[model samples]
Target: MTVAVTLLLASLVVGLATGLLFRVWALALASPLVAVVSAIALQSAGFEFFAGVSVIVGCLVVSQLAYLLATFHLHREKHSMEDEVDGLPGKHRQKNIRDQYE
Candidate 1:
């Protein structure tokens, strides 16, 4: 694979791991930094403009998607655990504030 593609994938994987394994907002910011560094490296390595841009965009998109999915999974797990702890027969717990209000 090209350097651009390799960097993009690497950045994405790191971003996903950050989002999934850590809940800290500051830690999640590393993905964008990685993307920027990869894009710069690609440009320095004589990559075409389109290739560099593609890698940058791909990195951002993948990182966002990973973050969203990870957060969603974490939230779902949290709510499920809460429900289990409630142990209310014939009753279900609401997962969010909106649900509780409604």
Candidate 2:
């Protein structure tokens, strides 16, 4: 139980970070690599074949969902910031997003 929870948490964190900080290609490459690594680790931990497969599947699914959720949040945030900039008064309005920060 503890191991399962830890695996899920670790996968979620990794997915969220990668989604936010890396490109889609990198995340695509990472999923299979993580699966392979986790499989070996689970084998050494003495998990049954089916149990290990299930855990691997759960980790991958949870991680991918987390990545999708994080990306959606970033997309929404960007749009909201753009909308805020559009609301700025004409004389004070800036063309670029960086201006919004200043």
TM-scores of all candidate predictions against the true structure: 0.61, 0.71
**Where is the poorest 10-residue window by lDDT in model 1?**
88-97
Clashes of 1: 0
What global local distance difference test value does model 2 have?
0.79
Candidate 1 at 47: error in angstroms? Answer: 1.2
Model 1 lDDT per residue over 1-102, tens place: 377677767766776677788875844477668777887888788879887788788877776677677777777745565456655422343345447688
Cα lDDT for residue 23, candidate 2: 74
- Give lDDT tens digits, candidate 2, residues 16-96: 987898778877787987688778778777889899899999999988888888888888644555457666544423445
Which predicted model would earn the best TM-score?
A: 2
Model 2 — which ten-residue stretch has the worst lDDT? 89-98
- Evaluate residue 23 in candidate 1 and report its C-alpha lDDT on the 0 to 100 scale: 75
Pairs clashing in candidate 1? Answer: none
lDDT of 1: 0.70
